[model samples]
Target: MSTTTYAVLVLIGILFFVAMDLGKRDKGNDVITLISDDDDQEEHS
Candidate 1:
């Protein structure tokens, strides 16, 4: 009903989403990963 209430609801929603995401990651259901290799990406002239 108020700004503070809305903010708290949003925070709770975000925390729940993050908790689910972490659970999925632990189960290896996520496919995204970071494999950056700057040296291998150098310009080949």
Candidate 2:
């Protein structure tokens, strides 16, 4: 209806697509794998 409305709609659409993509990628693997690396103190020491 208005330029501002169209702009807001487009911004929302882009955010939705980005969230979907992140969720899809997260489903395939163990998200906690990064935590294992955090336990390795030898590397930091």
Candidate 3:
């Protein structure tokens, strides 16, 4: 296989492991959210 092929294979393996690790951490299937301050809302009023 060429260098590019090897690099792609390695990337795929890394992504697979990362996905599995993330899946294992799930509990009760809860959704995670990022809350931002409503600074713009205050300024517009």
Candidate whose lDDT is highest: 2
Off by over 4 Å in 1: 28-45
Q: Write the per-residue lDDT of candidate 2 for residues 13-33, one digit (tens) a residue.
A: 999999988986986355455
CA shift of 3, model 2, Å: 0.4
Give the better candidate number (1 or 3) by lDDT: 1
Tell me the TM-score of each prediction against the true structure.
0.56, 0.57, 0.55
How high is the lDDT of residue 19 in model 1? 94
Error of 1 at 11 (Å): 0.2
Q: How many backbone clashes does candidate 2 have?
A: 0
**Candidate 3, residues 1-45: lDDT per residue as tens digits?**
699999999999999998877875773244322112355556677
| TM-score between candidate 2 and the true structure | 0.57
Give the Cα lDDT of each candidate. Answer: 0.70, 0.78, 0.69
Candidate number with the higher TM-score (1 or 3): 1
Please identify which of the two predictions, 2 or 3, would achieve the higher lDDT against the true structure: 2
Predicted candidate 1 versus true structure: per-residue lDDT over 1-45, tens digit per residue? 699999999999999999988887795433333222443465442
All candidates: CA RMSD (Å)? 5.7, 4.8, 6.5
